[model samples]
Target chain A: MGEIKTVIVVERNYLMQAGLEAMLMEIPGLMMVKTFTGDEVSLAGHIRKQQADVLILNPLALKEDPIVFLRKLKQIGKMVVFGLMEKETPVNLQSHFSHVLNVSDSKFDLQNKIRSVLHQDTRPGNHNLLSKREVTILKQVVLGLTNQEIADRLFLSIHTVTTHRKNINRKLGIKTVSGLTVYALMNHLVRMEEMGGATK
Target chain B: MLINKNMKLADVIHHDYTLVPVINRFGIHLGFGNFTIQEVCKEHNISTGFFVIILNAFHDPHYFPKERLQSIRLNILIEYLQKAHTDFLEDKIPEIAFLIEKMPGECLDDRKTYLLIRNFFLEYSTELKNHITKEEERVYPYVLKLEEAFLKGETDADIKKQIQDYPISAYEAEHENVEEKLFDLKNIIIKYLPKPKSDKLCFQILREIFSLEKELNEHARIEDLIIVPKVEAMENALKLKGFGNG
Candidate 1:
């Protein structure tokens, strides 16, 4: 890898932030530049000043509108924006971000996603941002619901759920549905316990 | 003499009998009125997490369904408290045991132990503040709304629909904040435990810190499992009554 990338983790959860910090510390080429808890209001100025390479943002911090904050992060320039999408992330809001990571993803997949996004050789490609359908599918995956379960829950055909999963994996460069499940938990999508319901 | 569920903390404080139990348990004397749990915690050394549990018990809001509290039978609460105490002992006892091993050869200073104890309390207090703010401002409100809706006999669909509009994920996110602070405080204790230069004061401070940790851990559990779920139910009830939107 080139020079180690610095990451500023902006998460609302104290425990998750500490855990993420510990996990990130174990990674080879990633350094946690700083970490802040709570919403963008408490963090905007500090993040702007720090100018770290990546800002790991928990979207739940945006009490009013997350898109506005995402846009603001984008405008700051040179900082890669990765959002921890909640389970109920609105459809309209999904389109605005460059890359969306579900909070439910596993530790291994989360590290992989972070590494892939941070170390990608090319200048950030047109971020294959997740669409509304993709997010819903991802949520189902996080819940460990099979294609059949997802189809039933969302009132769609099994085929559609599979297609959504495929699209999601393709866009995110993740290989398996298991990878998606890990992504969902680490990113706080559906929570780990909820997955037991859909895992079968 | 029973206070209504809608009664404010100010209202409860006005009743001498109700106020006595609150003051006795919390060690904070509120002069003649119902005060919010936040106020009570601030007055006492007790954590707001502990106070939240007591508040929910007092005010059976929709999100904070009475059922969750009922589920936490005395035996279960005692078991949990025991486990929490055990965890504290496991974590701190070793350090103290080691300090005791070294105490005879090394001389311990009271100043050093006092400094360490002070730092421990400071760190604990900081974490407690952050944890309380998140619960009061986000998690408690959501739970209260949920409880309110459920109490009104709203269908799951109606509750789901209402929740979809307001969302509970944010409150969960706030839970993560509390977790991080707890971790930070733990690290601080690990880092700052008095270097016992062969002294009894170090042992004394260690014991106090260990006890404090035990109390705080139990407080956190009660808030997370009991108060949080209850508040969610109350919030649901409020939503059902169309009083939660504001």
Candidate 2:
């Protein structure tokens, strides 16, 4: 009902934690209630005690088991957990957190992603998610190889590879080869440079 | 003789010997006795200062009065570095140059072949230069300083300052750069070489290049497992001393 205000920072690095706290405190109506430097066990405890509106997490502190920690955080209730990811966030882990922010992103982009997660209606709509295998098939398709060529390369039957391509197209609403290529680049699935002869 | 739980002499000796080849394979030749005491202490997670004392005992035959296992450790490390990295580099560099020279005539177009060859030369040269520079300028100097401080019985503060200023990522970034270039080179060769119009010369060059890439990959692995960890431990010790806390 009211404006979302309280924030709790859970990060391992002392410098980063201090910086984030300072930034959050500067934002009007946003209160950084507590900051803790520890792994998931301590973080879970802090969340329960603090009952803060949002939890800013440094994913590295989850100690090589980010998914398990994410699941644990989800069980703690309605509090939103945003992860500070470096470069690329693992796709499988994307489902658990409310939003992921790349640490290297420009300050403005970061602020926008955070604001969208906190205030806007950018929730990913219902779409049948492509399996990792399907994504691989889609990548190959973007590479401009025919079904038989992909099947031979992957050591799969032509029928199976065709099925995967169909599924990928149906799920992602990518009908044309050009569309698949654009999707691959936009999602950081494959860099434009790596596409090489695929573009032509 | 009561051995401290933290001082498992046999385990230390085993780890020390095992890591010699690994260090050598990485092309790191910082000298023997330079690493044994520091390395063993690191495996056991002891302070760098204490490690220095152990190194001192090992270096002086009359000090700890034990057999000169530390010297043996250093000798093995030197031998390994010589055979694995140094000798391999001597053999591989010439072979790579020969392959690059021979590679051009094989491709369908002279321009494409020249482009590929030039890219390979530039990428490899850049990566190798960066790698050597970092080791020479930052990593090696810090190791030398740490060893010197240990020999001089200098305080932790002095040792810590040297460790703090070491370039830890320079070695890693160079490795990554080489990896990227190797990937591109491999793909280019695979796609363009061995075309139906290809002759025997092209095949030979491609084969040699592949082998050279494999050797470099193995070299990178040794750097990661052996040299990098030692450098990292020294850096951590330095940071703990309130140096480079920023």
Candidate 3:
């Protein structure tokens, strides 16, 4: 059990909304806040007021072009906006959404996707995501060193450095150097001087 | 984490220590600081006003106020964002390039195929770089120019040629997601491509991609959520004041 992610579903189809709501009941780490079938909430403030962490909806319910509405929702930054699309829309909704659920994906897949999306949702415990070795590697990474450079500096082989780096990223679930640098700085693994992105 | 100037600087570090860079931006240095944030910043010639807004913004991005935009220095925010773009272009992208390049030599995969994959990534990376470059060259300068004009009490009639035709909203409509292409690349490697001859190297690159995704997401967040909103609000205010044509 973790911080239950508050979710609001707004699908244009009642059956679709009901099906999603039924699935939501089985999905752990998520609590339903509101479910609407149609004619609800074109305003960002409605969802913001719910203090929701994720919105699962067909943008048609929002009464605008789905793509444009998704952009507006993203710009609001109130929560993770998950787009519900049927028949594979042409837009790369992934660009605007945390995850886009095609109706074709299985219900099981929906549960899995929701879990993965909420993986970094800042739960109460288990904040320590890196091991000692991983922490050392992360420090090197933030200092703007390549894997090869980090390997030489640590007196480790290039292969070993890559292995450590891989495990570190896997454990922490972060992908970019900038992301790791931010995490490292947050966790005190790296200093301000180490961050390449830091402004002078 | 809640922040107040009177709170021990050391305490804030303990709460979310990643703020080292955040503080350093305000010229606060390491090695001392039983002092209040205000005292330390004062000694270091940092503005408490600037320091406070940034601190609040970092600690709780959701709470960043449109109201604060008018007071916070646009130059500091823009400069910081621009430098971050450079860091991505110069450091992270090339680092990924090197990792991808090394795969061909170490892996048992056909050299030609590996080179092909590497080239594909380089091209995608080139596109991403261009996206960042466009934002820096086109959008940022316009915002800076707008800020300068607003502060000087200039009207739309005065600087219509400068930027009345383009708005920050236009850029937001096409903002980049640092994770998007990398997400495609990762799926290709994991699901579509043949098993990597060196899984460690592959995963290492994936890690870098994740890092880039996270970093870029944060960067985009700062721009999209904070800076863009701030700029747009300023533009709206100036327009309403009969300074600029909407």
Candidate 4:
């Protein structure tokens, strides 16, 4: 099972608020923690106090400037701010929200959108994701090949091999050979039997 | 407010007890009834200004007094940094290892995950020790030598060759790998770990990792902001003195 994320819904309309809370509860990984009116005092503060992982709010319901308010909430930390939108809603929310969900969005659409947003936020920036060449080098590393050995086998220069290793470390967030091996095992880049005495 | 020399020693610790290790590195001990930072430093024979600046820098990440740090003697700065390295190796690393070593026993059903986490940490610590060893064995000695040569306004043929061959800037890249690995180590535990039977132990491991991370960051900041620029200035001075010539 994945990590559970606490979600708070902020909508002033009674029916919409209840509807959002119910739908969010049905999402497997999300726990619908609380509901708040749009103009609640220190709404951001309350969300933080609850340690919410996602805050779904209607921009039309905000008492203060939505842009300023959303930006402040973003500063609080890793929580995702999702805009609950209508057909013709505030334009500025696009910059602030991880994703915008229309009030008329089906329950299935809502779950998919929120799940994808959470998924994307959980990963490090996509720009640093490993390239195919880097992944190849990482596999060689997991197989217990030194830079020179890997370079010789792959018909690349030692300098090029070294650079690839550094990029793999940066992309995967692990540096040592053992750490990379564990990562490969967890990701199933290599089978457990292939590890042999390396991990032992 | 930033801690100053006149603040009571007790108050400083009260504000941030995590700084106790930072204070201890200066050869200062606890058990002062009620002494100001200045009085405490005076009694310990430590430079009060340097002590206060370190305290402030560690307490608040943004409270770097770069000019003041640059003005400090390199040996004094290096000695303080060396002590921090010792604290990490001798104290912090072992303490965290002790906590993590028991985790496998606690989560026997998922022993492989616990063992891998331990292996990951051990690998990180080894890299960290190597990083410190490189600084101590190579970089710090060279920086001290450079400072000595700059102060005397002349360098021998060997020191001069050393300057042109391996400048201070060459050592800067070594820091990045160690820091990035430590970050990945933390993320693995926080995001990727299978559920351990002992939540408390896992939480404690994270707490230690965070403290170690914070101290290492401050250590890097001092080295980058204070030591790097100082050495760069000395290197440039020697170059002006025609030390760059083969």
Candidate 5:
């Protein structure tokens, strides 16, 4: 039992919904938050209001424009989804859902994908996350400067420079100097010619 | 660097020992006298196909086609991915959060900044949940529907109309950028925050973060290398069936 993830099943079929509930019970770390029938009014509104983390859905519930409803969910960016369609429905769900599979996909697989979906290492928010000094350290690191050299050039302590280097790695999600160089290049913090012979 | 059919699982583990975690999920254990790779896997009910693939991958990570990911049924990869996620959400995330929470009490001087570190962790965890939720909720379900459609050789007009506005290409476009706040949280702990009085606590937390980072990197790899490619293939075939966003 880990951090519990609440799941909601949205579908039109009675038997399939019941089957999903039973299957979710057997999967550890995934608790059924609720089950919604396709005919339920304001279905999207209900999903928006729930604290559930994942939604297993059948497109038949929405009838006319399930994709439009999905686009709204995408825009909302709350409560991830699983598209549950009849085993024979022809649709390319790639563009809209993180994962799409037939209603007939094994319970074992449904549970597994749900678990994977819950655990992805998503990007962080508040775009301007790094500091001025940290950015400087990142460029120097990409330029192949050692902590002592960065300290000498910046008039900072060796310990402080080391701390900045560690922070830069954490903030940017990069570990290697080469990786830092790539990040620097991508962000236009440094130019190709400016890269130290380390990359040449 | 030679690989022979006769190579023992015990021999490989003894040589690098670090290989334990790589194959540990398959139930391969230590204390074996002289069992062949196939022999032990058979005893544990592990797929010999998956086990052999792991062995080759360990030998050369660049080994393309990753035989098991290619040769086995798609369901196998899906199952493996599920288990990986379960380990992450249930075990890793909670453990990291717990460790960060312990820091403030352990180091009083570091208390003020420790609060920031813990808060950032909570924020990262929530966003991670959002990321996972988006995929689980929409993306994976879409892929499953695509598979079903492919098998049955048909798709509905409604879905085709919806895909015109939202395509897999768009989702793939946004998946590349790394999680930003996560790095900030780690750095906040490493540089911005005051050091804990107990070096032991600091090391323990760092070790946990490192492992979490490692596990996540692998999870991303499976998605990018194994799962995405499979879905892309199915998507392409669907387009050929005249369901092409027209």
Candidate 6:
């Protein structure tokens, strides 16, 4: 068995919370840590203490502003949040979660859902792997072109170029020009000779 | 754990030793064997409420009581933020740079890679320095001056001219994302650094980078949560009073 991934369910509906908990137990390597009605005072404080790996929150059940509360929870540390969506939840609140699970998901569906999230969490390449567009932008970046110059060369709008550049930074996790240049060199995205002008 | 005034200073430090540097920033030195938080603050001539709030906010990211912070004087917050900037530039940045500088010597085979990483850090340090300089030289003074005019319910022509030329909202809009580079630097080191002879120095560098990143985030949060909104409110109030040309 792999490491036990603890989970906390915060749903206002007792039946729904119980059902989620029961199904989660059927999945190997997952431990149901706690369940909250979501209106409990200092739920944030309680949840912080529990130190669970995954928090399954029904966004509508949160007494405090869900967006702000979830954001704070995220800032606390690495916890994968799965929104327990029973009905229509606002887009803003839904954005806080990594994935959403329907109230009616069966045990098999639930197992798959948890597995995918856990896999993504533990997977190293899932985060830093650059998309094709990101690689193109990164190439332009290492070539020592300004945003405007890149935009012109690539026939992309300046806004698109900037967004792509930001995404490249986020994907590769290398920020400085030299850092990115080194990454490109290591990955053979560009040769050492290609970066001589920009790196020095 | 939430901090309160009546708790013993020693116990508070025990609760989160990371707060030692935080309290130190407030000029509260160690050696009080049994001073309560309130007593310590009183001795230091610091507002107990403000001290408690700053400690809690630093200890717990979610603990920021926005209303409580907004009520305090902006200059107090600015002064604290300025101290954080000074700490970053003078202590934290140099400490990290020294660690990175040691890397090339420690791993001669990967000297070029280490040097590239060092250069990246140097560039980031320069950017951070410039960002801090802009805040200290321009943004902080403008905010202090704005607060003075707001408190007096009057703005002199000079203050008005400053506002007309560059409003507080303008500063808020162009607040550079100075911390983003640190995120990238951390990722590069952790994920892509060529195999080093020893992981010891890399571990230390990553630790310092993480600490600096956390502190930088908190500093940015203070400005976003407290300074910007208060300044914007004051700007609106001044405008309503016919203080500056829109």
Q: Whose TM-score is greatest here?
A: 6
Residues A1-200 of candidate 5 have per-residue lDDT tens digits of 33456788887666787788888888777788666666443456556645466788887777458778887777445567877766667656544666775667787787777667666823455423678898888888778788899999999999899877765654555554544554566456887678648452
Residue A91 lDDT (model 2):
69
TM-scores, all models, native as reference: 0.30, 0.38, 0.52, 0.64, 0.49, 0.71
| Predicted model with the maximum DockQ | 6
lDDT of 1 by residue, B22-84 (tens): 334555554635656566556565655544555444432212333545454333343434343
Put down candidate 4 lDDT per residue, B1-246, tens digits, no spaces: 699998999998988999889989988888986999999999999999999999999987657666798889999999999999999999999999999888877743476676777777887888899989999999999989988988888888877877788888776543435765666777677656666565777788889988998998789768766888788888888888864464
**Per-residue accuracy of model 6 over A1-200 as CA lDDT, tens digit each:** 44567898888776786677778888888998666666444467567655577889887888888888876787646678888885466776666677988767677887898888788777445555788887888888888889999888889999898777765754565556767886887677887777766755
TM-score of chain B of each: 0.40, 0.53, 0.74, 0.95, 0.77, 0.95
Poorest lDDT segment (10 consecutive residues) of candidate 2 chain A:
A37-46
Off by over 4 Å in 4: A1-141, A144-177, A186-189, A197-200, B174-176, B242-246
The complex in candidate 2 yields a DockQ of 0.03
Candidate 5 residue runs with Cα over 4 Å from true position = A1-200, B1-35, B54-68, B156-165, B176-178, B242-246
lDDT of each: 0.55, 0.56, 0.68, 0.79, 0.65, 0.80
Docking class of 2: incorrect
Clashing pairs in 6: none
C-alpha lDDT of residue B157 in model 1: 60
Q: In model 5, what is the error at residue A57, expressed in angstroms?
A: 43
Q: Per-residue lDDT tens digits of candidate 2, residues B76-147?
A: 322333355444446565666666665555544444445445545555655665665555565555555654
lDDT of 6 by residue, B148-185 (tens): 98998888888777777887767766766566577778
- Name the 10 consecutive residues with the lowest summed lDDT in model 3 chain B: B61-70
Off by over 4 Å in 2: A1-200, B1-89, B104-112, B147-159, B166-176, B193-196, B238-246
List, residue by residue over A1-200, the lDDT tens digit for candidate 4: 34567788887787787788788777787888666666444456656555567888888788898888887887666567788888676565565676789878788998898878888766544645678888888888888888999999999999899878866764555656777777777666787788776552
Residue lDDT tens for model 5, B34-153: 987777777887787676665555554334344357555555666565665666677778998888778867753644355445655676677677777777777776766766776787
